[model samples]
Target: MRTILILSMLFCSIGPANAAKTKKPKSEEQKTLYAIGADIAEQIINQFLFEEKERPYVMKGFQDRLAEGKLDIEVKDYRGKIRQMIVDRQQALRNKFLDEATAREGAKRFPTGLIFTETLKGTGEKPTLKDKVRVHYHGTLTNGQVFDSSVARNAPAEFRVDGVIACWKQGIPLMAVGGKAELICPSGIAYGKAGRPGKIPPYATLVFQVELLAIIK
Candidate 1:
């Protein structure tokens, strides 16, 4: 009976110690993973901070905002998902250029780059720089988001091709008086670095499936 009591107490006293010992391995593993993750996170954050530091105006803006003490930021769970959303959006935009380039390569080998798959010898009418042309067009972001469409709204847009974005300057010349074509415009040609707010952001390219309904003289 005394032996049983001593054994029971011994087991009871060691139980917590053993459980705690078991937890150390798991905690150590977790800590190692966390350290690795933190190192990776720090590297990314450091790179971003370095870039931000290069822009004194932006750094000043952040400092000004911080001084104003307007930071009531809430913690969001799913931070990885938020980061992934941004990365995916960027990749979505990038992939459009890749896809367009691939398509253009394939297209040059073919008769026409038209989605209609019809051979267009480009009537070579080549409208003037100041020419006001009426066209129906569908504009989409690389990620398949339709931003605008004169065709969808049942109205044709009046555009002086050259006066507008460079895409129009280059693309409209490829169209005849009545012709349909798709124009994949890179950011350099379309919106450039300064993009229209609310509708478009910086470094945004556009893909326009446009139909030249007429050239209004």
Candidate 2:
């Protein structure tokens, strides 16, 4: 008689709970909690590269914190060390890319550590530091991701030779008016440790295929 009464209570409790689970969050507090969950998932998971297998562990930590009201590990203890690891990894990658680029045929390492490889010899005059120049350039990262290209827009860029990045300031002088050359710029002479936030990353090595159109006087 007791077992039958217990079974009846179990089914009654399960039925409404299962029905409630099927409906979306309706209360303001429930909606806010859901929104916070969605935002955290997007920012942490999508913004960083996490392995598929690591997701369950991540959720476990999240669940523990919600249920136990405490973190499995303190973030302050490992945050600095973790940040340094990422920085060191990025530095090593950039160094390896620059080393291989320097070994390419016709590659010349100038005094500023810029690697210049001429693809087409120019017949006209080269631009001076003070000269305003017009040129088309296709810029990419070491991984062949195109970051910017005036050539793609079919509009040539005009700027003073001394006004651009250190790599361009030194590189433009090496190209004659009609010449095309590849400029491999290390981070120190390019955007440096803090690169363009959206367009580039820290410690990136840039490759620019630059064609000198004219030295605008």
Each model's TM-score, in the order given? 0.50, 0.67
Task: Estimate every model's Cα lDDT from 0 to 1.
Answer: 0.59, 0.79
Candidate 1 least-lDDT 10 residues: 109-118
For model 2, state the Cα shift of residue 113 in Å. 2.6
For model 2, residues 116-175, the per-residue Cα lDDT tens digits are 999999999988999999999999998798999999999999999999999999999999
Among residues 3 or more apart in sequence or in different chains, the pairs in candidate 2 whose N, CA or C atoms overlap within 3 Å are none
Q: Which TM-score value belongs to model 1?
A: 0.50
lDDT of 1: 0.59
After superposition, which runs of candidate 1 have C-alpha atoms over 4 Å from their true positions?
1-96, 99-101, 104-124
Best by lDDT: 2
